[model samples]
Target chain A: MMKRIGTYLLQSKYAISVTVLIFVVLGASLATSSFLTGDNLITVLRQTSVLFILSSGLTAVVLTGGIDLSINNSAALVGCIVAQLLLLGVSIPVVILAGILVGVVIGIFNGLLVGILKLPPFVATYGTNMVVLGISTIVMQGKVIYDLPRNFTPIGVGYVGILPIPVIIAIVLTGVLYFVLQKTTLGRNIYMLGSNAYAAKYSASRSVLDTVVAYVICGVTAAIGGIVLTARLNAADANMGNSYGLQIVAAVVMGGTSLLGGEGGIFGTVIGALVLTIIMNVINVIGVSSYLQSMAVGIVIILMVWLDIFTRSKREKLSRV
Target chain B: MTTKSLGKRIGSLPPAVWMIAVMLVFYGANTKNYFTASNFISILIQAAPLFVVACGQTIIVLMQGTDLSLGASLNMMTVVWVVLMQKSLPLSVALPLAMGTSVLAGYLNGLIVAKMKLPPFIATLGMQNILNSVALVASNGSSVYHEHAIYKIIAKSSFLGVPYILWITIGCFFLTMVLLKFTRFGARVISMGGNPESLKVAGYSPDLATIQAFTYTGFMTAVAGFLLACRVESGNPIVGNGFEFNSVAAVLLGGTSMREGRGGVGGTVFGVLLIQILKNGLVMMNVSSIYQTAIIGIVVLFAIMLDAYIKRRQEE
Candidate 1:
């Protein structure tokens, strides 16, 4: 029975991540009085919601064997612009539309650059990220905008029947993504291309289209995540999304999605985000230097990727045998 | 015949070289006595450390790998050096230790990227974060100022009408050029990027080449960080900001392809100079620093695309 359970966990890469999550939850609960409390849990979940939102789109890009480093920076740029408009007394709904529009534009730019022009994803995204960052700083002129309008905070911090609104948005977004990845033609195309691009080309005619759509999804989700995060903090800063640069990616990879693209799902990413949130929450509660937070994240990313590679090699060996 | 050949040589120069020529004329026209030794010295001072860093950066880009941790690890090295000096450690001990720390960080990156087959950006991104945090933690979240006589002298010293820093930058550029041009390791490094199968068939391990390239980059960036700290006489954790991406841009702008080892340090020198001059001229002309980054970004993208287009046409 025990061996059977081990086999079950190994079959789906989610087992290791779930096991790590459990251990972290248990350890955090044991060590800190401030952790494991209902209020603290809710707050942590609220933060994880942003990861969920961004990772949903990123998972698609990663599944297609590409990455979108500009997502967070582009979103932050849009957020800064949107905040300026809001300060001018722009209506909330229009502000949201404007944000999404900017996201789609950036998304299309990334898609065309990476997919059509055949520039390496790193060069394209890194270039776009720098441009976004430069524009962001110029837009804000290096000043932080505090005090977002009161009603605008709902999608981020508002509670719907004792559950945070961000969590609801995350759940809805993840559900849509999960459905699209598992059940839809576009989803299969992404997995096919990611697993093997040359072979995918012979079989799937719309591979390029699928790749563009994946990046667009990534961009749009990043935009929404930025908007929500800004509302939650009630401020907009160009560097607000700086920390999110790799954490969303970390979550996606940790959740069992291979960084090499293909072979992962949105549901696993949820657990991955949860694990990171708990780890970060515990670090905060323990109050070890806040700077160490980045150190911890860096360690997590390296460890998770190594683990992924190790398990993949093992699985391949087993198949050969 | 000699004159005709010389004209052909000038015509064969990369677009970046021509762009630099145009900028020089513009700056020389606007800024009085721009070609004077004093003005040249000022530009060299600003370009010195960045050129040294780009010298190392050129190697990795040739291999189609990137060290995103270049700036952050350099920050860590400077921070480590300053903090150790502040604690009354002798320069002999502090200097080696700080340089060693940078090497160790790069070694770790090399291991992860080459052995584990992790993406260069991902592995280096992780290292970048860790090194940045280490700098912050070591310096206790504040800049450290530790002045030494050596730093002061280096900043002021000059030989033959050029600053010592510029001389050092030139030394680093040639050292890198020699390493990339005349060495078996250099040949293997380029081959590993463009045609790894060839290297493997020739019984060479591509992984070893990758590690060596990364370690060299780490060592060079450490040297750069030391030079920069000497000029400023302090260490700030955020001091190396924007360097990581800028180096990549410089390498690409130098007519280097993203892969296939199509360009080398010969072109990277001109690339680095172009960027530094553009930046220096903008500052000299009083362009707002805010607009400068955007302009740099646009220029970087446009140049890279143009290079790509030219390469594609050549291939056809």
Candidate 2:
């Protein structure tokens, strides 16, 4: 029975993430009554919505065996552009479209560098990150754009019946992405390409286009995250997305997406995002010093990746036996 | 025929050398103060610590790994040094302790990458966070100023009309050159980058090479941190911010292949100089800091793209 259970655990995609989430939730609940409360849970979900969107996009890139460090900066730049446009009395829809377009352009640029030019993804995205940061700074001049339009706030804070709009948006995007990843031939191509690009080449999978599309999707999602973030804060700043880059990476990796690529799903990412949010919430509830939060995050990331490597190797050994 | 061959030789020189020559000609024509020896010395001084740090990054990159946490590690070392000095510890004691902390930080990063088989980028990213937090905790989020007579003397004093910092930087370059060219360890590092599996097949542990490379990186970053602290006379939490990217840019700009062992310290020196010169030239040209960063970004992109094109052509 125990062996059967072990096999079941290994077979299910969501099993490990679900198990981890349950433990985290239970731990949080036991630590403080505030954690289990409906209000706090909603708050956690609301806060996680932006990260969820960002990580969803990052997962696609990781699955393609590439990374988009520029996502956070792209989001920040988009937010800044949207905020500036709104301040200039542009229509909200136009501003949103412009932000997303900017993201797509940046994404295309990254795709060209990584896909066609064959530049290393890390360095290429890092260069794009710097360029975006510079543009964001030039646009805002290091100042915060606050007092956004009242209509824009709905996207961030408005409720849809019992659920927050951001949470709803996150859910819808996750569902769409999950479908695209699971049901489409393109999705299969992406996995195959990431798993072994050399083999994928001979298979004629249009791997280059697949890589480009992955980054484009990543960029669009990050832009959406930026818009939500700007609305939520009622302000935009060039530095707003600086921390999100590493955070998204953490979430995507913790979700069981291999950095080596081609082995994770959106369901795992959602649980990973939740785990991170809950850890943050627990830290807040316990009144841990804010200075230690980054340290905690770093430790969690290392532990998660280490656990991943350990488990995969163990499985390999067991299979060999 | 001789002239054609000479032209070809010049053409074969690393892009950084050409960049330097062009910038020199352009800036020499455009800015009146650009050609002055004093201005040149100032540029060297500014580039000194960055050169040291980039040397460390180059070594790690040569091993097909990266150390994104170097900037944070540098900051932590600086903070520790200053905090210890603030507690009335002598320079001799505080300096070694701070340096030791850097070695430990590097060792931890090496351990994660070598033992756990985590990608260097992710491992170093996590290490960066941890080190940044440690720096914050050590400094309590404030800059610490120290103006000891000995500290100032070491940083500011000159020998043979060159700044002490410049001398230290030169010493570091010589040391790195020797380590890379004269040591078996260095050969192993390059070989590991060229092919990790082959090293294992050859009965050498790539893991040891990885650890040693990171340890060297950690040591140099600590030295750079010390030099920076001495120069600024303060240990600010944000002092080392953005350095990781800058150092990586310099290393790559120097012609080091991001993939593995295709470049070395010779190109890296020129890369560091090119960045410093660019910054100095921008300042002289009155370009806004924001535009300066953007231009640097563009330059890095252009350099890598050009390198890629050249390499592809060669392969063809």
Candidate 3:
């Protein structure tokens, strides 16, 4: 019975993440009773909502066997642009639309570079990131744009019966993504392309177009994340989204998504984001030095990646046996 | 016949060389005294440390791997060196200790990639974060100043019309060139990049070559960091910020293939010169720093695309 349970655990896609989540939750509860309180738990989920949106997009790109290092930069640029537009008296909806459109255009450009020009994803997205940073700096002139209209606050801070708007958005998006990934032909093509591009080629998949679309989804979601963040803070700066680049990558990797592509689901990413959020919250509650936070995060990322690799190899061996 | 051959040779030269020449002429036309010997010497001085760093970066890139920890390693080395110097440790002890730390950092990176089998990108990225934090913690997030005469002398002293820093930079490049061209390890390094499977079949360890490449990179980064600290006479935690990307950009601009095994230190010299000239030219043209970055980004994208196009055409 124990062996059978072990095999079941190994076969289940969500098993490892669930185990990790349970461990972190229990540990955090032990560290501080405040961690399990409803208010703090909601706060953690609210903070994780923005990262969830960003990671959802990244998961699509990663599922296609490509990465978009520029997602954070794209988000920052869009946020800055949207903030500027709002300050100029543009309506909030129009401003939001403009921001997302900007992200889509950048995504299309990245798609062209990766799909059509055949540039490596790292180099192409890195170049795009630099360009976006430069442009954002020029737009803001290295100053933060604040004093946003209050109407913009609802998407970030508003609550419907004690549930934050951002959390609701994250949940709805995850459900939509789950549906698309499981039930759509394009989604299946993305998985196939990531798993084996050579085989995908002969199977009538429009590989390049699919790759482009995946990046577009990544860009749009990043832009939405940016918009939400701007609303949360009621401000935007050139460097605002810089930290998100590495953080989002870490969360996605921790979520059981393979950097080499062809495997992973959005649900795993959600758990990954939650785990990271809880870790940070615990660190904060425990009064760890801010300087050491980065070190802690880095160590956690390495450990999680090692654990992932170990489990994957074990699972493969078991399957072969 | 000689003239035609010479024209062909010039035409075949990397795009960076022509870009440098064109920028020089443009700067000369736009800025006063841009062509003076003093200004030229200053440009060379600024390029020296960057050239050294790029030389190291070139080797790692030839192996189809990257060392993103370079900038953080530089920052950490500067912080450690400066802090030790401030504590009244003799320069002799402090300098070697700092360099040894860098070597250890490089070895850790190599172990993670070579032994643990992590992708170089993720491994180096994590290392970058760790080293960055170490630098911050060491320096307490503030700049450490060294007002000693030795620091000034090392930065400003000249030997036969060349600065001491310039000499050190050239020496580093020369040593690396020789290592790449005249050593068995060098051959193995190149082969490891070009064909790892074959290297394994031949009974030589690619893992050792990877470790050696990273170790060499660490040494050069330490030397460059030392030179930078000397020039400024201060160690700021952010001193090496953006340098890793800049070095990668310089190496790529030098016509190195990102795929590995197809570039050399020779082209990297011209690449370094090209970037320095562009920076100086933009400043002389009164362009803002932000716009300069945008322009450089555009140029990088264009160069990489053009390289890809050329390779594709050749294949066709």
Candidate 2 residue spans exceeding 4 A from truth: A1-7, A197-205, B1-8
lDDT tens digits, residue span A163-219, model 1: 899999998999899899989988888887789854725543366678789889988
Cα lDDT of model 3 by residue, B1-316, tens digit: 6999998787667668887887888888888888888887888888887888898898888888877788889899999998999899999999999988878888888888787777777787788888888999999998988667766676789999788988899899999999988997788877777888888999989999888888888899989888988887888888887677778778877877777588788998888888888887788788988788778777767766776776666557
Q: What are the per-residue Cα lDDT tens digits for candidate 3 across A1-321?
A: 999888877778778778888999999999987998888989899989988987788888888888888988889999999989988999988998999999899888898888878887877887898889888898898799877888887888989898999998899989988887778987888787788854725543367788889899889988999999988888999889866767788888778887778788899899989988898889888887666667766776777677666667888999899
Model number with the top DockQ: 2
Full ranking by lDDT: 2, 1, 3
In candidate 1, stretches whose alpha carbon ends up further than 4 angstroms from where it belongs are A1-8, A197-205, B1-13, B25-35
Higher-ranked by lDDT: 1 or 3: 1
- Every candidate's fraction of true contacts kept comes to 0.52, 0.63, 0.52
* RMSD (Å) per prediction: 2.4, 1.9, 2.1
**Per-residue lDDT of B70 in model 2:** 87
Q: Which ten residues in a row have the lowest lDDT in candidate 3 chain A?
A: A197-206
Model 2 agreement with the true structure over B58-110: per-residue lDDT tens digits: 99988887888988998899899999999989989999999999889898888
DockQ (Cα-based) for each candidate: 0.65, 0.69, 0.62
Q: Give the least accurate 10-residue stretch of model 2 chain B, judged by summed lDDT.
A: B145-154
Candidate 3: list runs displaced more than 4 Å: A1-10, A197-205, B1-12
